[model samples]
Target chain A: MPSLFFYLFTAITLGFGLLVVTARNPVTSALCLAMSFVGLAALFISLDAYFIGTIQILVYAGAVMVLFLFIIMLLDIKAEEGKKPNLPAVIGGVVLAVILALQIVTVSSSYSLGKTPLKNAPLSLNKAAETSVLPTISNDLKVGTLPDAKLMGLTLFKQYGFHLQAIGLLLLVGTVGVVVLSKREKGGQDA
Target chain B: MITLNHYLIVSALLFSLGMAGVIARRNILIIYMCLEMMLSAANLTLVAFSRFRVVEGLPDYAAQSLVFFTITVAAAEVAVGLAIIVALYRSKQSVEVESVTKLQG
Candidate 1:
């Protein structure tokens, strides 16, 4: 069952990703990107990271893509039909893709295959207390159910509070900057 | 058995495709979409690692938190980036990469 889902999500994500790059119409590309994001979210859910999967759909597929579509609509740009594919760029991209594939294979060759600890890992928090041979400090911190989301919140708020504050500030600045930058100059003058 | 390597392979392929789109496309919007694709690919790799690789007794969500923060920042980035693209379009009436030559003076 797990393997089937893994293959399905992988196929959809990669297929839509390919379409996003190859599609001529910008709108088509944007929609394909959304489909790719949905596939990615499913992959996350299959991995048992429920919070991240939900946020993946909410943020990337919902909010971000909508922003892209709105801009594309506002601009009303035509399909880019006149531009010819640059031979050198296409060649370089293929070369880079080959290099990346080789690098990942080489790096991951050391890890034991199919050795994920979650294979028989307990799902409930209470079960963790009964099967302990490791340090109890970290294990004790684990929340019983939905550990991924709970631990994420704990770590983000406790260990990385300052970083979260910085991100909030960054978002505020970005929102203001976008508003200011997109606004037209008074009297319809050139910016 | 879907191992960690399988997720990494998919992510690597997606990243490469996004890279190709960024390098080959002339339209600014398509490039932006590709950039988002690349970000999503990275996020997938992170989530996969978090799932399979246990950190001793830790509940294996540190990497997931990182992905969360990354998504937040990506949202902010797209907003600002699209605004800049819109501003450029207003003045130049073109979205092609080669046409933005106001600084070439």
Candidate 2:
């Protein structure tokens, strides 16, 4: 069952990702990107990171995509019908993509590449077996605190609370900047 | 069962597709959407790694939280980026990157 879901979401994500790039209409590309985001959110959920998955749907698929669509409408982008495909650019992209795929596959196949250093390190530092931010469990305990949405909230509030505030500030600044840059100057020009 | 490699392969494919989109698309909006796709692919890999790698027998929630922060940043980026695109369109009347060469002047 799990494998079935993993494959399904993987196909959805990759397929829509391709469509987003290839669709001639900007609006269609945006919509396909939204679908890709949905598939990505499902993939996150399958990994048991429920909070991130929900935020993926809410922030990415919902808010960010809506913003993209609004801009597309505002700009009134016509169908990109007459543009000639640059053969050199397409060929370069394909070659680079193939090289990247090969590199990632090669690097990922060696599972212990980054693990050896930790494997020899002290258990206290590397594993933190005795203590952590999450609720502690005995080594032989049948149940453990698997990182889920609840644990994620605790981690965010405890460890990253200040970072959250900083992000809020960044958002505020971005909002103001957008408003100022986009607003037409009085009696001058649309820009 | 799905392994970490499965997720990594998925992410790699998405990232490369996004790269292709960025290169092939003439429209700035489509290119920007492709950038968002690339970010999503990276986030997927992060969450997947956090899932399989156990520290002290507990899942690494920190990576998941990092993904959360990344999403927040992406939202802000899209808003500001689109606004800039709109502003450019108002003055230039087109969103093609190749045609907008005023920056070079």
Candidate 3:
């Protein structure tokens, strides 16, 4: 049953992923990318990564993509003349696709993927346990807690707090830089 | 039905689509969306591998955390990148890559 949801979510995500690039309108492509993010988040939820999935929907699909759309709508420009795409581009794209397909097949056949330690891994979470997911199916598994979002929270805020803060500060700086770069006076340009 | 290979196949398709967008498209905004697609493909690969192979049927907390970080960075990147593009659009009134002057290569 859960796997059913997974397949559906994966299909939706991949479909929107294609549409994001193929769509001609910039606004439409941005919206499709947002849909793709939501679909991916749903896939994460079906996989039992509840917290991460929630944040994915909230942050990426919610805040970030909205920002992109706001800009797209605000700066409504007529579509520019598309480049005269040629045969070489098509051939290169096909070559890359074949290489990636081969990689996926090689990866699937070699690794002992599905059968190893996932036969009966439990899905329930214990409240006091802090970690959400159940124990590893590996017989020799030794990790005490099944380290999940809560544990990740602990690590991010405690052990890696500085790095996290640094990232935040970096984002703030980027935001300011973008605003400054984009809002410069037109008089300064040579054209 | 939902094997690790299934996720990989999806990721591969997403990556290929993104590559096509990058190679063929002239619109800068669409190219940026394609870049996001590629990044999402990488994230899917990381989470799938951590879940199936590394953590071995356990909930891969580290993968989730890494995915979160990647999303955060991607969010930041799009913010600044799109702002620049918007500014360019305001100045030149277009979003075509070849016309952007910075992407002639």
Every model's TM-score on chain B: 0.92, 0.93, 0.85
A75-175 in candidate 1: lDDT tens per residue?
Answer: 99888787777778778877887788778767765667534434643344555444544344336535444445556776798888998999999999999
Best candidate, DockQ = 1
Q: Which candidate order results from sorting by lDDT in descending order?
A: 1, 2, 3
lDDT of 2 at B43: 96
Model 1 alpha-carbon miss at residue A134, Å: 21
Report the candidate with higher DockQ, 2 versus 3: 2
C-alpha RMSD in Å of predicted model 3 compared with the true structure:
5.1
> Pick by lDDT: which candidate is best?
1
Superposed by TM-score, candidate 1 places the C-alpha of residue A161 at a distance from the truth, in angstroms, of 1.7
lDDT of 3 at B23: 79
DockQ of each: 0.62, 0.55, 0.50
**Pairs in steric clash, model 1:** A125-A144
Superposed on all Cα atoms, model 2 deviates from the true structure by an RMSD in Å of: 4.6
Where does candidate 1 stray beyond 4 Å? A110-124, A127-144, B55-58, B102-105
Candidate 2, A143-172: lDDT as tens digits: 433436666777788999999999999999
Q: State the lDDT of candidate 3 residue by residue for A68-183, as single tens digits.
A: 78877786744434535555865786687678767866776576654343334443334323332333422113333343555567547756777788789989998898878776
Measured with DockQ on alpha carbons, how good is candidate 3?
0.50
